[model samples]
Target: MRRTLGRMLADSRTQPAHAPGASNDPLILREARADDMPAVLDIYNAEVRTSTSTYQYAERTLDEQLALLSSKQTAGDPFVLAELADGSVGGYATYGPFRPREGWRFTVEHSVYLREDCRGKGIARPLMRHIMGHAKARGFHSMVGVVDASNAASIRMHQAMGFQVAGVMREGGYKFDRWLDCAFLQALL
Candidate 1:
């Protein structure tokens, strides 16, 4: 599965056998597109506004989302989308360089965001699986996730997928009027 980024991008969408929660619409895993920015931003901006899922204090605008997408694309990172049959985005996943230094080239930091209504519905498993596969295919030696300590659900999900707690940065972030601890999880690819 050592596919080039172009080939991965050209791959067709998949209608997963997953039947998340009570919903009958089986999600499709596909490469994100420019037109999908609005839906993707809705899911991300919501987290920025309401949860510790993202540490950003302000919601992103459409232009900002597009710019982020462009940066990811330029860096050869994969941004995946989980979509229902009706075309609504349920979640998104992506990974980028762990750091700007060349020594960190073999490691990547990933992010996965699912809509609030879509959580605990088994949607995350497939999204993470795809992203992991994509990273491995690209020859990344390791994948990492820096999650908020309060986000037990996300940490658990990563652990279930072979990620181990690397360490914890005590009070690494401040948001919502308090300091939030950050848990670092790593998985060998």
Candidate 2:
């Protein structure tokens, strides 16, 4: 029972001038639309197939993306997509339970991805802040970001957002024919 992008935007009482003109800003952060599946999937699959941002070795099907959207919508998770000035989906961010156990309910893990061309335009900070506020309002006590050890940009961004490196799991993941370390960072809400 996910809502359409049109309805979501129209019903959003706090929609923050996403268009280009008076704001002079072209980037739009909003709830992901079903029509944006292809672009979002392309972005995710590219990372899954190439980068260490995601450890999954296989690309996901469109149906998987649809299912994810449905689940997030049902759970009231904050899944947002970034739209470029030209209306293309440039990136996305979402968070889910850090662990499934009842005692872990107060913690969550977040992931943010931006298209190569769209990086460094000051998009991630606001997006992360928005999600942080949403999680805080929902009574989450902390947020965790598990980053690839070699992803300096992501680590820096998390640090800038007040997340501290909790620990590192040495050689925690195996991908692309090599072992990858994961850096765990946490921020108390």
lDDT of 2 by residue, 1-189 (tens): 023322322333233312111223556879997888889899889899879999999899999999998888899998898787788887889999999999999999998988777788777776787788788899999999898877767766676676766776878999989988887878787
Per-residue lDDT for 1-189 in model 1, tens only?
Answer: 113222322321121222122233378989888999999999998999889888999899999999989999998888999897778888999999899899999999999999889999877878888878878889988889898876767866776676776777878999999988887878777
Angstrom error of the Cα, residue 126, model 1: value is 1.0
Q: For model 2, what is the error of residue 58's alpha carbon versus the real structure, in angstroms, after optimal superposition?
A: 0.3
Segments in model 2 whose C-alpha atoms lie over 4 Å from true places:
1-26
- How does model 1 score by TM-score? 0.85
Would you list the C-alpha lDDT of every candidate in the order shown?
A: 0.79, 0.78
RMSD (Cα, Å) of candidate 1? 10.7
* Residue clash pairs of candidate 2: none
Error of 1 at 72 (Å): 1.5
| Top lDDT prediction, candidate number | 1
